[model samples]
Target: MFSRRTVLTGMAAGLFAPYFHDVYAQSSALPARLVLVLECNGVYPRALLSTGTRAALGGRANTSDRLFWDAYKDTPLVREGDNLASAISLGPLAESAGKIDLVNRSAVLLGLSNLIAGGGHSSGTGGLSCAVNGAGATVDAVIAPRLRRGAPFDVLRLGTSSARVSIVYETCALGPRKPAGIIVNPSLAFDSTFGSLLGGSTNGRDRKMLFDFALADSRKALAEFKGNSNERLKLERYVSSLESLRTREDQLTGMADRVRPYLPVAPKDNPLLTGAGSPPDSLKWFEAQFQIATAALLGGLTNTVVLATGTSGFDVAYGPDVSDVARHNLQHGLDAGQNWEKVAEVTRRHVQLVANLARTLAATPEVGASGSMLDHTAIIFMSDNGEQHHSTSREWPKLVVGGNALGLKTDGRTVVYPKYDAPRNRQVSNLFNTLGHAFGDADFNTFGQEGSTRIAPGPLSELYG
Candidate 1:
């Protein structure tokens, strides 16, 4: 007969023994991954649509009429016009258009209003995660625990800007108002967040020493809190968070070991990229982060990630000849011919980011899986507002990519909702709830009040296989 202490020790070892090996072949099915790419301000809807009168003059004025002018009624927005064939198009994403059935793989929910009654960037942030009324969890937070289970690095919030207001959430409804721990200084040590298990580059023996130290410290901390009632609860949560971090560190170390041999060593003069003056470098770093995030997901290190492209009123100079206008101002110039061209350029840049992520996922072979990592992950790309000036959420430019292997049809079909008055439109919460349902939360209906009251029923069924 086994003693209780021996039995418990055996159970613990059984749970963690898999960490000793790559464990990629342990499961045949890859875990579901969710990534949300959020662009500050809003997307220029006109850049997404090619219908209605393209005349430079004032053709029609009704906001409702503007909604129907887009190609959602007859064809996917990508096929609407010739100018958009190359400009403001999904670019390389065109490859994914027919391979996955749009009608079966994805759904576009247009005309959904952001019920939040405030104005400007903060409100957009609030509306993007929590509903307009500030009464629901961000979709990323809601689905994180469910999808990854005990995996480390459940949700990573990353941003390019130093402004805390842009990257962190103020609303409590979005999930406990925990500080996001934003990585503003690119030079900041990754060790601070992922050091213990992976170790730092000081000494040859430091790796094993650090891991042993972390384990001892964790055990001591647990033992100290065993007697204190209130302290025990706090320690429990701390242990939980730390354990998750430990798993992440282990997986990251394993992946780094595997990929480091194939990667070029960092150049001595590789200054950390920062600031608006370095758009090209900024774009490169952004792409690098996306690659890192994809690698983490493929390695089972994390299941959810939120990436912010630019913050509200983000003012980055393109060049001396180009307009140095901010994102919001540039978006407001949608009706102007030159402004539309600029908008198309910006939209193209955004699409390029998506393309980079998609390509990375497509390239990574899933462990113990037949398809690529891209086939198992669902990516939602959206902006806070549909257009620059309108502020209304009607005819919002949103896209859902990947997740085909997890029962999503991604052929790029556009689904337009019946026109409604601005107030009665589907709330952005609908998208949040729909995402939750996709991750296997069957009870995930009615996010915000406006979402429950106004949005169409349940998840958008058109995208599911």
Candidate 2:
């Protein structure tokens, strides 16, 4: 009877042989990286439509207008032009306040539907996983290991909620019945990722000591147990998990010198994060999480990250202008009685933050490559729900930036597929499949849950170079 530890060891050494080899023998050139930014309450579809696109669709203002949906029902609309910057929601990404020009490297995707995800206010993990009620591994988790380059973390999940929750598991997942955790507290996230660089905090030391004690105890049990019973198998699995965790910790601790140069200025604690009933500082948390993710990417700590905000079950009060308004109310189109300007501002803030990330990455040189870090990375901003609050999962829009090195044809393009009811309509799973292909997973065409909603197999060929 083989022990669980032995099985895991063999799998790591043999099943993932090529990945392990790449980790130790990677070349100076940087591998492709991915960043996914997901937000709740859906994106206002009209906000993404530029003047030219609006004109092409017969100058429709209301996206819900039957005429608007019919305009692109039979034929898809694909345009790459100078008018992308004119879109209200895309202005910040096109030309940030900091003057970074990402428009040429960006693409706006529209008309993709995902009914299998069961969208309403939010799709829970379904938005990324493309499984009903988040019943499978998300795209981030699926691709992280394949793209891994010996980073301490293959994928880092970070998020901020309207509530004072420290962590959440509603977004990404590892596999079926396995949900991943997103660090909601910035301080805790920093302590976990960069704490070792600052000589290790008391909490870190205590955790390490506990791990050591558990490992010692487990080894003693392994020595004493003579039979390969179910109990012993469980013990072996537990020990293997502990050992893997310890190895990861040791790797992070050994990289102090390498991580120090890229460390972010640690976030100062805010009083608003104290009480359970106190409103969360949404803006502050967003900024801190973005900074930490960027630092982690630059320091070679993680290659894939999911930065989420107001996902399902998270009704965070937004930043300054809309701080007083209930996020849920805004989602219902009730910000100061039927005006959506506040909602637009909230969406714009998320875009501006993404723009800042793109800008910083564009200015920084790749660690072991010729061009800037932004050139080798793919950044995606998407709505967790579909096109509107209480969505019917009819249309989903995405804003994609960078990834020139990964064969993505994102050169100021605007792609509007046929309507959801159209026979040729595609789903969000196709996008994930496309990304899987871009990451060099050539045969990763069937990515998510399949049913009648699936238009066809394979990646969106139009997205690739």
Candidate 3:
């Protein structure tokens, strides 16, 4: 008889493996994979929208989720027609952002609103799930379960080691009122997934074998079911899942080996005890989270990931590069007498991290598949509130990267839905449903705030390929 811990050890190692690996099989036909990146205190709409957007819209003022221009392919993600990739402020990845944007599979969702969010810090689950206190599962949770047979962990919530963020930063809600737990520290997260075992074992190889054997038992169980012809049909998915798990274990093992050098080493003492200083290790813990996220996606450990980049709990004085003040202050434009450029710098830093994530996935060669890992991923980065430090729920423009996967059409276009006052105005719900469509869920036709007369129920067909 296997102990509960032992069973769990096997389940964790293999549950998601089947679903993630099969759905994420390297193909343009695609399966379901989503990475949702949410930030607080909205970014400016002007900065997010390109100069070409107006002309593409034909200078039309009122339209909602309406198709404006169809590139059918990606172009430079720079503002206006100019291809100044270097000026995009992706930090170390600035060089690739310009060139990649041209061929990158992506899109932009403009004019999204969360009237239900009630503005302010309520942006928490409000912005993510489009319902207060996560009254509905966020898009990530809703779609994650659709991947193949569902990943071991349906949704993996991750938060940066930065200081505390407002309620606006709640990254994921598994179901109605079910906010997902976040693993704040990357080192702890790594151990939880790959370190700690049931028998207080710390050796990575031993743990891997133990889990692998447990998975072998699961496969045997499926085989027992298969022996009876009557049960074979019902157990087909079971057999596929177990087989996928066995195959995915190798992927996970390879990923672990590849990411070992980039892992963050923990400290002997809690550095929060200090009165003044950085985290005491300048190895970039934020970067570590992205590295883990990449491996998780690449290895099929999870199909959905929600990352809240910087919180107020970890105070980072970015120094002369951004500011000597806390991120919260910079977010609110309170530090240094509200230096807007400083705020932009902080926002850019977040973008840079996101850019790095895209680049990392792009670099990884997908096993038994074509293109890179990114070709089979869809990453959405958006703000909890509208375009301002404080929001009015008017305009929420999100940057999208990764395409060809998830059945996302308009992969290379900027779509501005009708404004708030327009007759055919679309709400944030439509965009969320659009994601649902990408996940291949016929049931997720419409999600969020159903009873209201103003609510529109449907996916953005214009964006759904």
Q: Give the number of the best model, judged by lDDT.
A: 2
Q: Please give the TM-score that candidate 1 achieves against the real structure.
A: 0.70
Model 1 clashes, total count: 10
| Overall lDDT per candidate, in order of appearance | 0.49, 0.71, 0.54
**TM-score against truth, every candidate:** 0.70, 0.87, 0.67
Clashing residue pairs in candidate 2 are 162-316
248 Cα displacement, candidate 1 (Å): 4.4
Q: Which segments of model 1 are wrong by more than 4 Å? A: 1-30, 50-87, 95-109, 117-119, 132-135, 162-176, 179-256, 262-282, 316-323, 328-337, 420-425, 449-452
Query: For model 3, what is the alpha-carbon lDDT of residue 351?
Result: 68
Candidate 1 has its poorest 10 consecutive residues by lDDT at 10-19
Write the residue-wise lDDT of candidate 2 on 251-327 in tens digits.
Answer: 86677555555454444533333322246656656766777677666666778888888753557865454556667
Q: CA lDDT of 52 in candidate 3?
A: 56
Candidate 1 Cα deviation (angstroms), residue 194: 6.4
Give the C-alpha lDDT of model 2.
0.71
Off by over 4 Å in 3: 1-29, 54-99, 102-104, 148-151, 161-169, 197-283, 311-317, 331-338, 365-370, 453-455
Residue 260: error of model 3 in Å?
A: 7.0
Q: TM-score of predicted model 2?
A: 0.87
